[model samples]
Target: MLFDLARPLLFLLDAEVAHELVLPSARLAHRFGLSGLPGGPLPGRQVNAMGLAFPNPVGLAAGFDKNAAFLRLFAAFGFGFLEIGTVTPRPQPGNPKPRLFRIAAARALINRMGFNNCGIARFVENVRRARYDGILGINIGKNAATPIERAADDYVACMQAVYPLASYIAVNISSPNTKDLRELQRGTALEGLLDALGRERRSLARKHNRRVPIAVKIAPDLEDDAIPAIAERFLAHEVDAIIATNATVSRAGLAGLPHADEAGGLTGAPLRARATEVVRRLAAALQGAIPIIGVGGILSGADALERIDAGASLVQLYTGLVYRGPALVREAVAAIEPQAARMAA
Candidate 1:
């Protein structure tokens, strides 16, 4: 609506700068109470997956509210669940300023923002201060300075720190920005890492006497064989949930978009197809062994439904929200609510 109309002005600014601008503006709107959640009652359609009750199936993906800086404000934007951080044990300022780019013609973006986050301690502090009441999952990653061999240590440290705070924890082993992060998704690496984390989850649950689900976020660039192989591991390790994808390095679908040549993970309209296929493959392979949190290029209710039809238990958005603004969430919820109601009936 208004956001689309104002896009020309927003497009005038540098991509990263515009992204930085959105946060403060949203925060200000919060101060005036103009910051609001979706208008309609969400039907109390609570579903338990990964040991958490999500009010609905739509979620704000990990990168949007990194550092937990704005979950309270985001809760007002109509997402059923809000996942924040790719937080590492210590804070590091991602890649560099010009990292985020927009391909308006194709309705896409390319970013190599190497997990710039305000360390785990600050992330914990921020989450503690937020007033959000919905499901909050914290996404954890290893520090860039940490070698790929020792990455498990950073994940372990972050899990130990944010465990008590997160409703669930997501292990991000797929962000292409990191030099060898995706390597962790390999057979031996993924199994070893999850084994260690799984032990920690059990130990912490017993010690604190509280249970929380642990999910893995994966990349979209893999092949058919790769998808099922990963799914097999998830089931074997008893992972509670899987966020079907993170952004991809492939530009296969964005044939006409400008800036398509940029070297980074491709997200938005261009990514919708391949991402959903990944979800479908994973879902079929897992056979409901665990819930799948489908994310990639969801920009509409139809897009959301396609993922669900493909077997995604929940759907998430990132690049779509950026192109469409807060209204996108309301639209997606409105689009899905009727089907959800009919399913309930």
Candidate 2:
């Protein structure tokens, strides 16, 4: 309700400006424990997946708190887990401004922000400085100018930099904005990238005496054949998990909505069915060979449970939280508990 009231004022500014401006205030709210001011039943629930124990399964996805900027805020809002970055090894300006668009009618967003971030070093510093006590995942990407052929090196470098601080690391090979980024999802290319990171995971584990999970985030804009192939490669390479279905480049789901023609990834309600389908396909292929973290189009408790029923062990949210606010999280978590009890029965 507060966010809805603020949206008229927020929407008046550039989308990106509203994003940066809102986060700091949220952080301040966290500092003062203002987040607890709203009266409600506490939503603290424990969930275990991917060999890590999450306080709850609802998490803020990669793009929201890029560079780990709003950990305190998201933690305060009761997210069980928080992911930050799509950070490259070195800093680079993403696509020009005006890259973020809100499709209010559809409760969707179309963005080509291009992974603009403060790079791994800055990200490490910020994350190290944050006071959040929940799970943190780091999403890493390659530089926009990096050739597709050399993408493995970039992923490895990012892993090396963030491994110490990250509870888990997400290899973001799905963002549509970077030139040829999705190409890494193809057969031989995908194997090579995962193999390189797999080797590093072992090396880091031996050095630190702790193994951090590595999850691959893939796009929903894939052929049926591609999903299984990627899953097989994941099993073969021993990749820890998969974030089944990132933002969709195919606008087939949101055809008549405003900005449906927007030239970037599509997320929100229109993304629900297709993203759910992707999670179902992945679950069939992997058969829980490894856990799948479902992303895309989750705006309600039923929506979150539908993804879990479709075979996701956990779920992440981005656009839905933007459209619905923190109440959505509580409702979704509340919804999950009853279903979880029934499943146990």
lDDT of each: 0.84, 0.83
- TM-score per prediction, in order, is 0.95, 0.93
Off by over 4 Å in 1: 36-41, 339-345
Candidate 1 residues 1-345, lDDT tens each?
545665688899998898888787867867786655453325423567987777788888999888898876778776788889899999999997789899888888999999999999999999888856678889999999999989889999999999888899999999999999999998788888989998888999997899888999999987789888988888888889999789889888677667788878988888889889998898889898899999988888799879888998888889988888877776666566766644533
* Model 2 stretches with alpha carbons more than 4 Å out: 37-45, 339-345
User: Model 2 Cα displacement at 48 (Å)?
Assistant: 2.1
Per-residue lDDT, model 1, residue 167, is 90
lDDT of 2: 0.83
User: Judged by TM-score, which candidate is best?
Assistant: 1
lDDT of 2 by residue, 51-143 (tens): 899766777789998888777677766577888889999998899888898888888889999989998899889888986557889999999
| Native-referenced Cα lDDT, model 1 | 0.84
